[model samples]
Target: MSHTKLIRMTVDRTVEAEPGVGPDIEAWRRSVAGVLAKSRRVSPDELGERPEDLLAIRTEDGVTIRPLYTSADDVPEQPLPGQFPFTRGGDPLRDVNRGWSVMARFGVNERDPEAVNESILAALESGTSALWLAVGGDNLPVEAIDRALKGVLLDLAPLTLDAGDQAGAAANAVLALLDARAREGDGVTDRSRVSIGLGAAPLTTLFANNYSPLGDTAKLRSVDLPGAVRLAATAVNREETIRALMVDATVFHDAGSSDAQEIGAACAAGVEYVEAMLEAGLSIDHALGQIEFRFAATDDQFQSTAKFRAARQVWARVADVLGARDAGAAPQHAVTSSAMMTQRDPWVNMLRTTVAAFGAGVGGADTVTVLPFDAALPAGALGVADSFSQRIARNTQLLLIEESNLGRVLDPAGGSWYVEKLTSDLAHAAWAVLQSIDGAGGFSATVESGWLCGKIEEVRAHRETEISRRKIKLTGVNEFPDSAEKPLPVGPDGTVPDRLAAGRVFRYAEPFEKLRNRSDLHLADNGSRPTVFLAPLGPLAEHNIRTTFIANLLGSGGIEAVNPGAVESSGLADAARQSGTRVAVICGTDKRYAQEAPDAVRALREAGMTSVMLAGPQSAYPDENTDVSPDAYLGAGIDAVAALAELLDTLGVR
Candidate 1:
């Protein structure tokens, strides 16, 4: 439960004479003025900086938060814990006695049963609270499954299939195998602690370059799919014990999202799923009960923890709105992000995952899964290094659980100013966005209108700008790029096992909602280009960057550089001719621009342009080596005015 107090700023405390017992308002004013004269007045400078006019920042969800919050921010009508709404927490103290579990996944090689057994044994020895076994294929090799179950107790969370893969066949195949095996052992299939990885399949289908089940039969129809995902979920209910379900955040970062966007998107997705299932005949309790989330565990601990707390408030509000009879009022699961992990300095991922895992635990996540650091680089090439990364992540969680015992406290970050403020802001923002979605007639409607993707794109654009400008420091990638570091090795013979492909496709969609928000690739730099065309190639909202940047450049150069609407192939020739523009500089990011640069350059050349300048780099150029013959480029931190000046000199703009 939150214990912070907010104070209200008001003049109500100032003394005033009562009408019945004292003088009139005029007399009171006169008296106050006389008292004020006794105090010394200060010069203009002494007044210090005046506060900016208070403005409310509204989140995409529609939750409004003021610039400042005080004691008056509390809702007196809001119920306390252990009561309706459960806004403070599921319990008054947030169920602090029981800490959340640390879940670890053991990779099973279908051909090597012994290796699978050893991996699970190592995970258990390393103090992982639950066993997360990522099955190799559709048919769970009985031997591999036995290895995972060898010494693991029935109460422990079992190996489960990930749903991030859109192929229903993979999800169904794992479910069928788990069901078959469970029936052979316990006879009551419901007594197994396992997850079928049903969440986020839809979103996963959108990003996968390969096969996707969400596509129409026009694509591939050979796969037999599950009618409802929860049927797989219900198959291993585990009686009274809460079973783990996967809620992944990988796609969110990969999709090019911000930390706040990650939390907001995940919360929205979860709400949609819960509401949808409930409407389709499942009880609210059962719907939330059988679910869990898997978020990208990045290096940003505060934002990650805030994501967890924000998720709880979102769920709590929904529960209050529903007023369900037997619904447990807790946020289900929190998965860490893998987007920030780098293949360059693979060892650093351990520290990154540790921080992310801590945030999840403190933020009230039911379980935390830290993806291995080297996992970002391929699977087997750096096999030993990847194993170390995984072990380090596990050890970090164990050390926290046993030594620091941070998990022992509920809302450990409750009263702190920073955490409280972050929580309040996150909740209010996410809530508002949820309300907006509701007003728009729910998830499917918003998706149809492209409203959901639009919001994500907006946030993604801002983050991209920050990252490009180096406002956000990714240690090895940008901030402290290693000059002497060797490139991460790829798989031997560059051959990757097909099983990994299945696993990659099987990630939950909710986590990817934010993690996948990353731009497809990094942008190169623009050295000096007079006419820079900022074409936001991919699925991003255009911000009139061409005009703004060119205007600023022209202003510095004592010339008028024009931006001709949005630069496109059809109009490039006309716009350039009409505006008397010469060079066209492309200024989009990797995700969108990298794939579109070649065509844009070709079209520009055919339109009679002599030279093309890339505002970013050749990395974003469509054809790697086939030069559109870009003459110059500019990266983050380059002086915009300087770059433009150089370009003007080249173009004889004076």
Candidate 2:
């Protein structure tokens, strides 16, 4: 064959359609055009008017959730379960026989060993397949593992430790228990079930110093990493199938990290550990096997699902590069996020926990730990799983596995085009950040440099801004808050580890709590909450929505809104004075505002109202176009915190 002929043959193959094909994408595109034409597409006068614009919500992780997904969108190759990438799952069929382990946290009060023993025995007997004991802290003696687990069978329930800084000491105590139990002839039949989270992410000890000057001990603290890895080797050396170390992505997540940041930091930490383990003389498989990845499952259902799937994808890729394809299947343990928990309406936390648990299950977590409804409450406010709270937490899994039968299908969210696309997007985004962290000399090094701390603070500011604006609503605190609710009583207190980490575990609802506290202090001093008067200018229906909106807005900041009933424009000033509030918001429709708001706002301003706000947009009654204008606007788009602060200042509440 001539050279020209060979080139022609190769070029012809590119354009040739040799056989029958599936449905035509061009035909679908034409159909979509027809549908849009027939449906009479509306004009996008506003940004959100367009379907794509309205639905394309960008997450902090830098992933944009599109309105619709299709086959045309680039989808990652769907590897079978337990395969490379491990996006579908690592233990392919594990959930079918034994669904995710019900690992409930059982905090021990060693001062009262009898109560602690009874609690542990009761917890194991009642649905809990594993125990995550608080090993450090004054409540749980660092060396009293055997005493706490006296009645509990070591062979049955898998035991994990959260020993804080004393993690190495705690693991030694547990190993001692295992040795003593072996002498008693009750040994682990399948060591695969045994896991001790000797995961001392020493970086957590240096984590975030709350945007302050870096301390001298901060970078120096993670020196414990080598000791943690060496301690982890003991289990691997014994031929035990226990996870010795952990990648605590939740620490980053709870510290206000975006989903991608959390996973990226985790992968970075895992890679750092892998390198350290290789240098420490452990084989790649042994090193990978000795570690597990832990992530927080938040109430954002699909986000959490994408999070777990993406985490595994990133870890699998990391492991694959390290020449351990089998070990790439990252074992995951998910717990409901503490950052999503609340303090005021503690009961609502159950719903949040349930949703998080469901997401964790759907996300294919190997072990799911649902926090108690009262988990956010102080130890004095809650004991080792109050009966009601513990039952609810455990039953969250029961409802999903037994009742909902969620475990029947392997990788239930596997082929979903949305989930798959989301998982791919999340994986790539997280991996990019992970690569950046690697470039900066790994996880511990990032902490030492305060790069991770700075990154976290940026996200924290964004989240706080959203919360303060009420753009992200907290059901009880910022919306339908219970003003009359009493504070939940705390349980007996215990000493928390003086963790070297100088960071706050931020929640979106935390700012609201501060606002609520200010309100409490105001009430105590003045015998009433800082109040806003509703100066309605029209009928009930016209003014009710805006009035209620303003009320909720001011109330979100712990200020009360007083409505002296809907009234005409002429009576607004009298009603404002009768309501006895300095902040008066004109509430009415645009049409009514053009008719009556001018007089109402004018009257309230002349009637000694210091801060006169309009419930609706200020553009509705522009001073250039009308007789009066509000001093400030109190509406959907305005920053709630700033508005409330100005209002409180006007009211002389603080």
Candidate 3:
């Protein structure tokens, strides 16, 4: 062949003219058209006038996220990680080398220092070397302090204290503990091996909370007591390693912040703590080295991971403000919330724990505590549940670090569009909140004004609603029903006894003596019914609204819906006609009414659809004369699964 002919042939073989959007898009377009055709042919209700036009992406704080974010997404200029304003991250290795901490938390009472030591050792053995000791101010017994110190690697110091008044008894108790640690040693090597768990000063507490700076009794609880403990963590073997004592995320998670809020709040709190300590005669370096952090982990992986990253960013920024931007970067610890635990189906807790653990690991939490499944119940009855929970937590990290090698990628989400966007959004939102707190005077003022509580309660309400609607599934409680479950055992205290309290001996007391056997306490369990019917009003292929609606609903209820293929009005009728449907749900865009809704409804009604329903907008009202009026509407007021659940309730299924 001629040279030109050969060149043409080669070009043709190597690259053809651009294919018109590929067969997949064509197929999808055809499928969507088919769905619309069916809807127009069979359903009238589906063609309702109101249509879902705009997609609003708003945060819980009412902050709207743009569809696209660019470098311009940041305001006041986006600084590089480890640089000033540290939004990306404070350390040079933000997402590349340095990672978060995996610290363990221990309640210190020290009745049996040996047992406490054992617990500490157990945590360390599990690969978490850092610790947080919960102490009761002056009320903390010497035994608990001794116990807290017993088994911990000398490098692991804890933030030890309870929420209580800081003066008098609490102050005295904290002082005693600190005095003990101080007496243990003083020189470099001795102090190097020691750690402090001091109370926040009354002023520090007030300032941190945005209070009126009053010396009031209740407001004085979080103050710094005399003789605080200090120790170094092996985060990176240097200030650059991003490993040191951290502030617990639980404080904020428990305080009611969203994942973003938690990140910002923890960072702000850390900054406040460090600043307070510095003014009190401690060096910026010591303050950074001494302070640590924690956060609550949940099933939302991206959100959780972003939370950890945001935390580091905020801490880095704060340190920069104080001219100690290069100081030791403490780790962030994570714990699954007891507040989210449920008694309905304890087994589901394992799944929740697993997802949360995964997020913690990916998010770079130095230490994570997976609340046992039976944690919602008395510990003894936890039985196999705790084993699974522990397994999930441990194996999750192991798999990530060893198998997946996720640990090899520090700041794994540094460059991802979603993560970076989320990080920026969270940092900005949290910074705004922090500024508001500052404007109110500080942490003390916010606490006094009940502003802090208000912030938390908002998230709490959302969580409760999600839990109730099964939007965020809790296996036994919201999804699977355990008919055989027994009534949870009540402790002498009136509420359900802590599962942790039953089987294990108190560190302050006996030598591994078993506590009360409360396994007899179980929630009432009924046999499970796995059957579920998915009701979609429009044609399977054509009625293109909420395609994932049924699937999402079923998944949340622990039941997977089976679609009967892409059908239109006739197909829908046929489905309701042949399937043993316990419930029927109608799904379509409101605009479907203008097309094929009337016929679809008639077919469904004709097919003996007893449980006919519409998945309409919560705020929309049905026209008084609409022939496709459903027996019930699922959405808004009642989510899809919730509607099914109501039907189930009628059938005595739950």
Residues 1-654, model 2: lDDT tens digits? 999999999999887877896566556545555555456564333223233434478888778898667777756567888888788788766748557778887664454556677777887777787777776665587666678788677556667777777778877887787777667777556655555566566555455332332223332122277887787677687644566677777768777889989989888878877888889999999888877888999999899998898988899888888888888886788999878887767689888888898888888888899987776665535444467777888888888887888867677887788888889899999999998888887888887788887787698789888888788878888888876665333222211211112234566676676666667667767877788888877789888888888877777777877887767667777777777877788888888877777677778888888877788776788565454667877778677777776666677765
lDDT: worst 10-residue window of model 2? 491-500
lDDT measured at residue 308 in model 1 versus the true structure, 0 to 100: 67
Query: Lowest lDDT 10-mer window, candidate 1?
Result: 515-524
Q: What residue runs in model 3 are displaced by over 4 Å at the alpha carbon?
A: 1-56, 62-101, 107-110, 134-141, 144-152, 155-249, 267-275, 278-290, 328-330, 385-392, 462-654
List model 1 lDDT by residue over 1-654, tens digit each.
Answer: 233322222233345544577435445444444444445353333322322112355433344445444443443433454554443345465334446767776654434656666776777776776655544343334335555455555445534444233334444554555555666685444553343344334432332322222222222122111333454245335333433233444545455555555555555555665665666566667776655555555566766666666666666666656665335454344555644555544566677778888887776666677766666555564647556767777777777777888867765766555566667677777777677767776655665566665666676555554554445555544444333344333233322222223333222221211111111110112222234333333332442453354344333332334555555556556665554556666555565555676776677677666666665544555666476656666544554434544655555532
Question: Each candidate's TM vs. the true structure?
Answer: 0.58, 0.86, 0.60
List candidate 1 stretches off by more than 4 Å: 1-98, 108-111, 136-147, 158-160, 163-226, 229-250, 325-331, 379-384, 448-450, 489-654
lDDT: which candidate is best?
2
Per-candidate RMSD vs. true structure? 14.9, 9.4, 10.7
Considering TM-score, where higher is better, how would the candidates rank from best to worst?
2, 3, 1
Q: Of 1 and 3, which scores higher on lDDT? A: 3
